[model samples]
Target: MAAESDAPERGAGTEKLWNETGIDPVELHLGKDSGYTLRAYRMSDTLPGAKAEEPEPDEAEDDDEDAPEAEADADAVPEDPDADEPDPADFEDEAPEDGDEEEDALDAEPEEVPVFLTRKGKLLVFREPAALVAYVRDNDDHDLAAVDEYADLQERVTEDDIVCDEADIYELDLVVANLRGGQEGWEPELLIKAAEVGRDLGYALKNDSIVSALAPGSPLDDLDEAFRVVAEGGLKGRFAKRRLKRSDPQQAAIAWRGVIAKINDHVEWRG
Candidate 1:
């Protein structure tokens, strides 16, 4: 991959780095020139172990001290007559129907999961998809048409859009690296291969898995959409077709590079 120093400023806190599989957490440091140096550490290294057991209290002394106090406290206060009586308002309002439980269950707020966008040496984190989308729209200089397509794509996304499992991690890494190389070094062949790999990866990883593995508003989501577009002979497909039709290898490379760059922003570090 061609080296580029486009990483955003490092935020404060202990950042957890992951392997290419986006599973195991590792300590990662950026090299002076290119790539990352990773260090693995066990969980025990950071967390404390179980505390030593405390001494047991004397059973005989405990019982003797509690007997008199328990009897005295119990005798001190008599139960109020009104304490047993149900509130008049409670009866007037009537008991809650069975559907109340279902209504309450429906009304309960859904849990929010955090999302992260990780690049070569930067990590952008967000809790909301809209914020991530807004950040991308404001900061990146991408094709407006492509951006709109991505926005429309989001609405159509279902739960089955992304999937990740232990077996697919290695393949995922290979495909992502292929795409990254196409973007960084402007290799047309790699871009084509990346697109092909993307289709398979898309099938392996549904939308939810992709978002959860990377970040909710990640560009990888758009890349998947781009792959679909290319497959369906859309704008990206036209760009690819034009690139392939060009006679000059250098010109073809340049054209393909532009096409790759358009979708490349979404490719990010999963770990």
Candidate 2:
């Protein structure tokens, strides 16, 4: 009888905590350590409200008068016969400018969001856990090995695994600097890897063929041309010897370094 009486008091305390913090107790329990917790609130809950009051007769009368005045003014306006006649152009919608279309395309591309790993090696990708689960389920036969490898990798990765937050852009800068300085032991493979990383991060243009990776008239176009000249004999064979033979290697290096430095300067670190 005493335990039954205490149950209501405990329930009341839980309700009080939930009302104050806006966190559901069930969600807190379900998310534990291995899962993620997402809480969304309605806009009305966050916004302040005006107190309800009796209607003002004078204000209501003023609004009624204004509505008729607006309608009367709109009706009083005279229309020209020429204005009523429509041209063929008026029937057709104006075609969007190429530049406007390009800007829209760029805006439509989704921005990359941050992802985290739970202690139990579960990947917590923002707003896409269900999609990820479905993908894993669909490709179980072909992707089981890859899934296991990723699980192992996530287990080893911690907050300390981050060497530099800007390592993606920094690696490109470092590779370009080495090329500029004519530093020995900087392999062609390093440049290839940098290109791949840059493209993955949306910094570099995607190209179908390796030779056409860098866009024309881009900041890195000169560097791409230089790379092409050096790699004419192919990527693997005598790369260092061919790289040294460029007519203005120093100028190309300086340009590449400036472009990368400008990019690094604009990078922001978000917590």
Candidate 3:
């Protein structure tokens, strides 16, 4: 994506320091707290430690994440004839022919995904611009420090350059309320922006549950697409409106609530 060059003006204008730098300051409103952070998108292969391993199963989740020990109720446990010799097919797939897999891999294109100013997989946000600027200038241990654009950030940033585009300011705190308002009250701009930010956070933070919840073709994603179509306003938009009318607002609200909770758990708030 092209860097946004024309950000809406603030104090001295939407601080052009980030413009064309492939990084932008953003304000996030979650629950009752609002904070400022930095985010950027880089090619998957180009990002430091880009290929995050599949996350281990959640400790709190059952069945979906992991099953309880069979020894807990040995008397009730069903006898399994094939438990001893597990099927090889269930554990792993047959390796593809040597050069064919390599050729296809070379032909595939790398995609761009979001990365944030995180440390040890936790997002770092600041309550004050001065704090965030100081951290950026003094800290080199954070994940973003490995990116090419980060050098410019260290050399050029100041407290005044911490401005964010209005478009980049996400009000996630209000997403649940808007969703609970039902179809008539749904705000396309608000819902769409929430989805965009959630997707970025999910990938950037390596939260598999969040990624799965908002994956393409999931119910929430379908809702996002419908809202986008309705926002477009045309004959198709009328059909989309009918679709949105059938969608459950409460379900959407709950799903978003879970994603927010997961994100809040991983946030490292600073002042």
Best model per TM-score: 3
- Candidates in descending TM-score order: 3, 2, 1
Candidate 2 residue pairs that clash? none
Those runs of model 1 whose alpha carbons end farther than 4 Å from true positions after fitting are 1-170, 183-210, 213-216, 234-236, 239-271
Tens-digit per-residue lDDT, 5-91, candidate 2: 222222444344334533221111111121111121222212223134557999988888778676788789687877756687888
Clash number by candidate, in order: 10, 0, 0
lDDT of 3 by residue, 153-266 (tens): 787888887878877888888889899998899999888988999999998888999999889999889999998998899999999999899999999999999999998998
Find the 10 residues in a row with the least total lDDT in model 3. Answer: 1-10
Residue 195, model 2: lDDT of 50
Q: Model 2 segments beyond 4 Å from truth?
A: 1-78, 82-86, 93-170, 181-186, 202-222, 225-247, 268-271
Q: List the residue pairs that clash in candidate 1.
A: 18-271, 161-206, 161-207, 162-205, 162-206, 162-207, 163-205, 163-206, 219-266, 220-266
Taken over the whole model, the C-alpha lDDT of each candidate is: 0.35, 0.38, 0.84
Question: TM-scores for all candidates?
Answer: 0.20, 0.34, 0.76
Give the C-alpha lDDT of model 1: 0.35
- Better model by TM-score: candidate 2 vs candidate 3: 3
Query: Which candidate model has the greater lDDT, 1 or 3?
Result: 3
